[model samples]
Target: MKIVLASASLRRQELLKRIIQDFHIVVSNFSEDSIMYNNDPKDYVIKLSQGKAREVSERIDHEALIIGADTVVVLENKIMGKPKDEGDAFNMLKNLSGKWHKVYSGITLINTKDGKSISDYVCTKVKFSHISDEDIQKYINTGEPMDKAGAYGIQGLGGIFVEAINGCYYNVVGFPLNKISGMLKQMV
Candidate 1:
């Protein structure tokens, strides 16, 4: 069966490529703004992922396995998504300075042929070293944090701020390769 990825994120695409070499990209029309965070970060991401997968599945006419994913950075129970502006990015960076945060990624797989679906999540704990205001400004100037959750990207220039991670590195990168691979194996 054909495999379809329901995301437009480059990070997710690159990670998926490591496991499935020939999957197709079908960016979902689902909007994250439509989902309300009910104070449960894990369930919120799972719902977002499921929404993306279901949206894409409805748009496809052929049999395929649709993979949908949503990732968020949570610090002190607060969900931090992409920053809206430079100031927002600065504040997020400041809040994350010298602290441990949780990265939660939700994955959903839908089998178009049978209408069966699987949804799961992975959480990774990431610690950031204390960052100076000047450094945060420099990093924000690079524009890497604007499109990333918690105003940072572990795989990009923002990597300098990350001191360590206690879970899947891929999960912090927003794909969770091992989890995705295992999920695919179970579905197939």
Candidate 2:
């Protein structure tokens, strides 16, 4: 069966390549803004993932395994998605400075043939080093954090701010490889 990824994120695409060498990309039309966060970060992400997968499944005609994923950075129970603008990005970085935050990734798989589906989540604890306002501004100037959760990308220029991490490193990169592997094993 063909495998389809329901995301346009380069980081997610790169990570998925490590496991599945020949999957197809079908960016989902599902809008993240349509989903409301009910104070439950895990559930919120799972819903978003499922929404993406279901939306993409409708666009495919043949048998395929569709994968959808969403990631968020949570600090003190507050879920942080991509910033709307540079100012929002700066605020997110300032709030994350010198703090331990949890990065949660939600994965959803849909089998177009049998309609079997699975949704799961993985969380990683990431601690950011103390960031000065000047440094945060400089990082913001790089324009790397604008499209990332918590206004930072652990795999890019934002890596310098990360002092330590616990749990799957791939989770911080927006895809949890081991968790997705296990989920695929159960599905197949």
Candidate 3:
């Protein structure tokens, strides 16, 4: 059996490498906008994850296990995806400063051979330290938050802004190793 990851995120790929290195990175060009945010955060992420996995699975053989994942930061029940631009990122960081938010990652794996599929969600509570306007501006200027949800990447320079987190740290980084390992054990 071969393992394939369906995402372009280096962070996720790196996380997966820490557990299982026998994998290939095949980014799924699935447009993330198709998933509606009106549904529960977990459900929405799962839908996106499934869609991504299916997108990649279509071109692979039955023995390939394609893994796809989607993450979102939920604040007050509102889902926040990757920021649109610098201004949007600034606002997102501002909103997250000194506040607690939930990070939800939906992971899905599909084995096209048997049409086997599994979808699960991992949640982490993260709290950010109060950030000054200047600090936020500096962080935004660096352009590190542009491609990250909630305008921050806990594994990057943005980690400086996070004061604490409750739950799997790897989930916020991009992949939940424990969750992924548990699922893989069952499938294998």
Give the best candidate by TM-score: 1
TM per candidate comes to 0.99, 0.97, 0.96
lDDT of 2 at 61: 95
**Ranking 1 against 3 by TM-score, winner:** 1
For residues 79-143, what per-residue lDDT tens digits would candidate 2 score against the true structure?
88889998999899999999999999999999999999999999999999999999999999999
| Total backbone clashes of candidate 2, pairs 3 or more residues apart or in separate chains | 0
Q: What are the clashing pairs of model 2? A: none
Error of 1 at 160 (Å): 0.8
List, residue by residue over 77-186, the lDDT tens digit for candidate 3.
99888899988998999999999999999999998778999999999999999999899999998889998989898988999999999999999987899999998887
Counted clashes in each candidate structure: 0, 0, 1
Q: lDDT by residue for model 1 over 1-188, one digit each (tens)? A: 99999999888888899999999999999988999999999999999999999999999999999999999999999998899999999999999999999999999999999999999999999999999999999999999999999999899899999999999999999999999999999899
Where does model 1 exceed 4 Å of error?
none
Error of 2 at 157 (Å): 1.3
lDDT of each: 0.96, 0.94, 0.90
True lDDT of residue 166, candidate 2 = 95
- Model 2 residue runs over 4 Å out of place are none
Between candidates 1 and 2, which one is better according to lDDT? 1
Q: Please tell me which predicted candidate would have the highest lDDT against the true structure.
A: 1
Candidates sorted by lDDT, best first: 1, 2, 3
